[model samples]
Target chain A: MTTSPPLLPLQLSDVVFEAGGKRLIKDLNCRFEAGPPSVIIGPNGAGKSLFLKLCHGMLAPMQGQVTWNDPDAVSARLNQAMVFQRPVMLRRSVSANIHYPLKLRKVGKAERVRRTEEALALAGLGRLRDHPARVLSFGEQQKLAVARAWALKPQVLFLDEPTASLDPAATHAVEELIRAIHAQGAKIIMTTHDLSQAKRIADEILFLFRGRLLERAPAAQFFEQPQNDLAQAFVKGELLWWKLGKANRKRRD
Target chain B: MDDFGDAIRAALNLLVSLDADLMEIVGLSLYVSLVAIFFACLIGLPLGAAIALFKFPGRKLFAVILNALMGLPPVVVGLIVYLLLSRSGPFGVFGLLYTPTAMIIAQVILVTPIIAALTRQVIEDLWLEYRDQLLSLGANTTTALPTLLWDGRFSLITAVLAGFGRASAEVGAVMIVGGNIDHVTRVMTTAIALEVSKGDLALALGLGIILLSLSVSVNGAVYAIKDAAQRRHA
Candidate 1:
């Protein structure tokens, strides 16, 4: 991985995204700098994934702006990577999947091969490097997806519910990988519905509800003394998705 | 029953003796169809990938047209090529009419749509899955085109095979263009037709057996290789 310039101080201002005549992300404003991992805890349909997509430039917000401190948007994009919840492995061997993005970036063959080997060893996928990536277990596929992103040596890595479908062992493996990535100096912005997972790794926490950022605080402070009522309810596990939906239905009709 | 037994015996004799005439026809048939397939793939793979990757106006219309062309009658294609290469037609100056080249052109016309349509399907499905990922990895549709096509190579092989199958089996197009000329463009299907018409039942049946075996052998060999490669890289 090459030492690229920092793409930090990422800011989103009044970022509004609508779909099918409904607003998925409201006018949301936030700023993230080079720091510890920031875990976004939210209920389903709270636009956590969409938010990540906007930040990664996978999507364009209908309004407002998602801007990096770097003026060159193209280079900024090249320096950030995202991993989705359901990993889509290319129809090739495991090592090839890691090699794909580097190839896309036109990384030289020697560097590409060296990084691919390093990623394989780091993910403990050295043995299955020749095996078809699509044939791997779901957990392993996610790991490969992460390793593939990490090989890019991005300054920022956004993961949207990457371990949502994994078992406990897989979840633990993914957490360890996230911590390792953070240690490598990439700011990690991830979303999780699992509160326990949030507690395990979040240095800072942001509570999202109904497309709005209701609260943002350091992890310990956010958990122990939530400033917002909804955040308090969410941290306490008192606000189930159905209860939120029932309240929404009452307000709608 | 006696005639059928004689035909079988004659066929075996032709095979064992390595009949020069039989080999010539077989060689011509393989040459024309394989060349046609080569051209078909050259035109079809990229056309299909474009249709799958880009969102231009008339895309759906083009998809429908390509799909409809897949079922086009070989005779109609032959007639079209025949007129195009006829003395009074635009391409007549090239004098391609009734030549092996004319036959190859007709087969290419007949096979391109099949390859393109199948390639479109394979590439479209892959694009749906890889669209976001590829875009994030700093690729636009243009750069992603080759990647999608390469990833879908295993399935694309089936498309090429389907084109080869169509070309090898169809007699109507080649017959019209090649004119079944002895030692010129005489291929397996046309020879069978000519032999059967001339009441040479043994030679006709022999040709038929060879053609059938040839089709089966090519398909069997391709399927074996395709299956093994797909499994290894699946």
Candidate 2:
């Protein structure tokens, strides 16, 4: 077995992304090492999803670089995968969907089958393997999407609100799936607005406000005594609005 | 009214008897149209996908031009192909003028733009939803094209059917290029034209009825298959 070089620590420096004539993701700098899950938590329009897109190489950074420890483009690409807020099933059976990225990476047939089975078992989707992926219920489809990404055995997995639309039961199931995936050694980088969910799954927290990373800390430290006032209000369960930035700064002055 | 009744009666009798000339004409028409549609798909699917997926300069204008070509008048297409395949023309050495191949060439030209334009619409819509994911999965435009084409297959089938409809129903291109020769290049549309011009109303109407029915059955069969498959997968 030829083991590829590690793709971490993923480092982004002075990264910016613009769309619709607006700088949606401002100049940002960060580094993610090979470790536990890193959860990016912020309100709407904070550019959390855009940050993930840049990190995953789905969108090019307008100003700076998103670099990985591995320099080879093919290996760096094959070693990362992502799941969206609403999973897009390939209009195929569940098993076929799991096999897709593996096929894209050109995994050997024998290894592909083994990894596919591992993913199905990981998500408890074994019985529904032959069912059409799009025909599955929403939660089941999300599971299939995560499992499909997992089949590549990527070094890093970026999930954009993997449980955003799911019910409590389904959310629990997915949370468990994430932990299981983490246990298997892939770095998890995800974004969510759900506070309790961040508490449940996040090993580290990166907080963004208005397209900028305002604060980042280990999960426990973030929830307990957050460094930034906005983050403090967020941790204290205070309702945050766009106007809150000035109001909070005035109080500080 | 009497002529109409007689024409309907003639159409039924000819259909029931399966006259040798009638069978030959029907077979040739189906052959030429089907072959033209096949070639059109081979060219159109990829061309449409590339136009949808790539961002080359003048791509939007290229798309507009392709859509405009879908409305090309069949007689003009026939005239152009006729010019190209005439003895004095570039491809004249092949001696393909007035043959079934000439008819196919003209019909392919007529149908390709229609298929390609409609396929572009279908694939473009699908690419909107699929682009980010496929790119995240490390698919470049070349790799994403086939995946988008396959995933858009059921929709693309409708595009092909529309092209086939245009190919099988048109008369001007085949009439101009094939010359409507008996037992040589006589397709249903061209034959109906010849019969009408010769004052053989019954045979013309008979061929018309058969042509209309053929169109309906082909469409019905494709829709049935597409519906069942969509239900299973959707």
Candidate 3:
């Protein structure tokens, strides 16, 4: 029961999200097949994190539906996990933190021990097995969070700004863990403002601007020649205000 | 002042010699309060956790009511229980009035709200931190309650101890309900009250010392548990 049912080919159709009477995600339609990580790149307030949360079932779209293999949200969620920007560590030992999800799933005692040890080894936290998770350094806590999620062996893993606040070394470590998790056959849907990080890990890029899905392209194609103006500005590190003004003009026209 | 010194000396002597009457009162106090707290926790912990974690109409009002009940006067509680257990009342068939059971019922009524209110505050704060994570892990509110309670066990210990403290120290409730029946319903608080009124300062002072020691010990146990949890999780 540790592994979830097939959660591949996650689809979002006509997804509309509004908060505080403002649209945050507008008519989002996308199909994410099982494959290399799909990196979402957008500027601040572009609803990147919200989109991730919506797709991960943390937030329900005000209209439309998000389905995984046509299953209900709860069934879909059983096989998925999300890592946040600042992951919360339970007030327990590192091993206990990793063991929690397995216990929740009612995995047997033997399997829990095995998966816990495996996850700790994968995250290189074996030495800190008995240490309290809260006392870990920020980087180590993030790693532990990933390991805890990884132990569940989710089919689709959503990361919202997983490395947003980490130093270079810590960022590299977390990125490597993300890659490792992906290599283990989980669909990685990650949101990052860092274009270079997106470039390095994304098999495909989903570009968003002002709550709209602007473009979805192969990683190489997106980096070489972005089709949308906002994508181009984002790729070239230009201010998005100019592109926003152009979009406003186009809308008005 | 000389009389106070004599009382202290007698208190110490009574404690050292393990006086039977004093011991009986101490034992009865512990039994009644512990039984009350056991029942209180059984009702309060889950009630508090549910109130904190769930949403429904009038939840705010329910929470306000529980918080207000935390300050309910013990004598008022005693009065209410007395009415219920008296021979003419609805539950009078059980003949529970002026008995140890009546004393326990009064204490339970007095302590349950304290445990529930404090547990709600502690568990509510924890739920804020844990709600998203637990829900994301496929746990609904019901499944997550025990996890939240277990993780917050150290603070919950303090809540239970608080209930015990309230139950043990209160004289009005047990006195009204138990009638301070000699060798039967007599407990430390009621005994102290009786001895003090009868001008028997020696027994009163002795019982007072035992009650104070019990309070100190309960608090010490709470602090010890808290420190251990901190060290384990810090």
Candidate 4:
């Protein structure tokens, strides 16, 4: 008999994070259903990235607990990996770098070779396997970072602006990889400053504004009709996000 | 001055001839320093990494201690070690006085802190860049330590080379503890001192050239490794 997976793979209850006498994330409660992927979108300083980190257990909430439905079923630490905007590449061969996490997990030699090749192939880095990871172009390096995480087959993947620094072509490549990874059954949770990217990859969007998760809705609905004023003005580029949106409009014209 | 020129010619001739005494001293210096560096790395590397990675009480105090130890006077260390291994001292039972083993002990003590302190700096620098990525990947402190070390391998090699250079060239500590016994405890640095004091400029000059060459080679190796690393990283 086959066992069915739980409906909600991730849950955060009244999560709060404060740093340096400032409330960064205040009392956030959210649940991620094990269906379509989730996206987190916000203006600069919206705490969107911080919230993604909290959900991935990278940052501990000051006043809440994050519970996984099957905490015992999988290693929480091992079941998720995040790709940061600026990736860290070890001073090693590309293949060796890609195989790093697998080596740490002590996967067998043959299996590591097989999976490393698979990851490189998926990331379009098959030819440069022998090249040093650091020597790869920035776009290639970012791809390597995603491939590195993808190699682990993490059940829940957290991506903090994986495409923020990429050009359009590189952004497309990364988005495609994200989609392929999501297709493999791992839930994708990402944060982005680019609304277009949010529109492209997000099935659902969590709109964060000034440390508050103001609204959560489907991706199409979030852009079509942001429930909160901050989010609404943000979608239309009418609010000041960087300079409080007023300056953003001035710069826009 | 003529003697000095004669010594240089003689030393070059000896090196060309592969002089047995010089070879033995060179071989011994390499072996003892190597063993000392190995032990230092095995112990000091982890210690430094811990000092950098963890936030225990007195950590700043420990850092101060290591920094002080890095500049520790070798002669004082030698005297302390000499006294400890003397007949009336507690470790006299081992009969280690004036032996190569005593020299090794002194060298290890002198070099370990250097290795530890330098490695700590390297690892600490890397911690800024990598700690988050590794943690996000779910690597605990235990797992991250090794990964950090491996990633920072180039820097660690320079640390080890620095330790080796210090251990090999140090005369004061190894001399007092080793007693400069010919054919046994007599290494390059101590032999140079004895030969120079006895007005035997040829031998002293020869050994000096060897020591300088050794230093050059070690430094060259460090640079070559660094360059290779940069090329790979590029």
lDDT of each: 0.90, 0.91, 0.89, 0.85
Q: Quote each prediction's TM-score.
A: 0.92, 0.96, 0.91, 0.91
- C-alpha lDDT (0 to 100) for residue A243 of candidate 4: 52
**lDDT tens digits, residue span A121-230, model 4:** 99999999999988888899999999999998787888989988789999999999999999998889999989888888889999888888889999998888877666
Better of 1 and 4 by lDDT: 1
Q: What lDDT score is found at residue A215 in candidate 1?
A: 83
User: DockQ of every model listed?
Assistant: 0.69, 0.75, 0.61, 0.72
Sort the predicted structures by lDDT, highest score first: 2, 1, 3, 4
Over 4 Å off, model 4: A1-7, A239-253, B1-7, B201-203
Give the alpha carbon lDDT tens digit for every residue of A1-253 in model 3: 5644577898899999999999999999999999899999988899999998898888999999888884655657778899888787878899999888888888899999999999999999999999999999999999999998899988889998888878999889899999999999999999998888998999999999889999999999999998887677678886765567488559867
- Predicted chain B of candidate 1, TM-score versus the true chain B: 0.95
Docking class of 4: medium
Best by DockQ: 2
Complex DockQ, candidate 1: 0.69
* Candidate 3: residue B219 Cα off by (Å): 0.6
**Top-TM-score candidate index:** 2
Give a tens-digit lDDT track for model 3, residues B1-234: 766777778788888999998888888889999999999999999999999999989999999999999999988988889999999989999999988889999999999999999999999999988877888776789888998988888889889988998999999989998999999999999988999999988768766877898899878987987998787787
* Candidate 3: residue B109 lDDT (0-100): 92
Cα lDDT, model 1, residue A54: 93
